[model samples]
Target: MSARPRPLMAALALAAVTSLALGAAPAVAKAPAGDEFAHPDLKKTYEATKKYESEQAAIDDGYVRTDDCVEDPELGGMGYHYVNPDHIGSTDPTKPAAVLYAPDHKTGKRELVALEWVVPNTGQPRPRLFDHDFDGPFDFEPVGPHYSLHAWIFKKNPKGVFTPYNPRVHCTPCTEDHAKPDEPKPAHPKS
Candidate 1:
């Protein structure tokens, strides 16, 4: 014959099973929409670069601004690119080659929107991270052929996290010329 279970133990077991069956599991914290860090690499990258949220801080760390704000008629705007020449070609996810920012329509202040990883094309298979492949072997001029990937960590990109452009990012101060992507891609402005 089986031994009888203790009353307290039986009660606890029943409650636990009931909770599980009724879907009353504990709640977990959720990262908001596109801001969610899907991988540890992304989280690490965000933590490492979050200080750049302040445009001044990014400038102090050697990120030089590009003259023209970037936009794609089809995909949408990518905002202003502030590139760190030192970070180019580095595979470390935390060290993005560029940071993207957009000027607020009213305030005209640049707000950090995204992070970009750029590696010069050296006949390599292609650089990839965060489960996404980099875009383009396009002529990056001066930098020449390169593959780039954008992480829309700071902004909600309806297209995707790794997409090169974001519909939500706008160039409030950008002129019409800079908004068109087809016109021979502009050269990175000399600092």
Candidate 2:
């Protein structure tokens, strides 16, 4: 094979530069085997969410509610979504009502994608895995006074549990259900 053409190389270089300039590249997720549960400080909180790792177990325990799916792009894409349950256990650190799920290609079931930790609002800035560098939305921040952390235990999040988006997660079009008139949505407001 002959060497690549100069024009083709130039086009490829230009495309790479353009994508980086536009911040079009997807974020890398974190490793799935996070031992936050082993942290002495967060032990209880981690234990609290263990059951939620199983979507059905969480639903039966009132940790989730049926028909709570909604359009969310943070996890993967259009088919990805967040589900808020009727109850969240543990007051010590507080657990997230929003459980992220993705449609399973082979099983045709909503498989658990991630679990979030929703801490109470204490009038301070939200939390993050890092200190003060988390500039994303409060609901996804893993640290801070009133913040949240999305733990991608079920799914691999190359960007880590604290990161905002997970490229591995996604949802199917028209898979979401309308929220009840009186029910409030999980506070995943856009920034």
Candidate 3:
């Protein structure tokens, strides 16, 4: 009779211990640090592009080259921002095209996104300049949970006017944090 009671107590004790163990476990771990997603190569790309821009600026004060390397704050520290070159209008500096990414608004996490440059041609070399008739109203799309991609179709010079070429897509995360508070905005916008 005592043995039977002892076994029942042991079972009860085991159940209690199991419950305690599970209860002590955490529901979620903290997000990784900044170094976790550090892309040295991307940083190098940014620096090199900046240097080129500076040199070009020195060459001609009026000469402004559009680059795809702008830092986006909305990505919550996962990727950087870039320009959408396909949207340039007739070499118009005022209407330069670009695409930027950051983090999702709902969750403070970076995501893979992209900006597509839809022009009238295809398969052109890099650094394709845009003209007035350049048919492009680029579309930006998200790639993965933490990467933005870009694709462009440009027109070739000389003969091809409306030929479709260069359908390229590349992905990169927007490693920045651009989130506003969830509170309602005031009647007047803050200066």
For this target, which candidate reaches the highest TM-score against the unseen true structure?
A: 1
TM-score, cand. 1: 0.70
lDDT of 3: 0.24
Q: How high is each candidate's TM-score? A: 0.70, 0.47, 0.18
Better of 1 and 2 by TM-score: 1
Top candidate, metric lDDT: 1
Whichever of 2 and 3 has more TM-score, that candidate is 2
lDDT of 1: 0.64
Clashing pairs in 1: none
Q: Where is model 2 more than 4 Å wrong at Cα?
A: 1-47, 66-94, 119-122, 128-146, 173-191
- Summing lDDT over every window of 10 consecutive residues in candidate 2, give the lowest-scoring window: 1-10
Q: After superposition, how far is residue 37 of candidate 2 from its true place, in Å?
A: 7.9
Error (Å) of candidate 3 at residue 117 is 6.6
lDDT of 2 by residue, 1-191 (tens): 11112221222233233321111122233332545432343444445555554555554444323332333443433122233323222223435545555666555665556655444456655555323223223322222223444455556566564454555554443232423457653332111
Q: Candidate 2 at residue 3, lDDT?
A: 15
Preferred candidate (lDDT higher): 1 or 3:
1
Order of all candidates by TM-score, from best down to worst?
A: 1, 2, 3
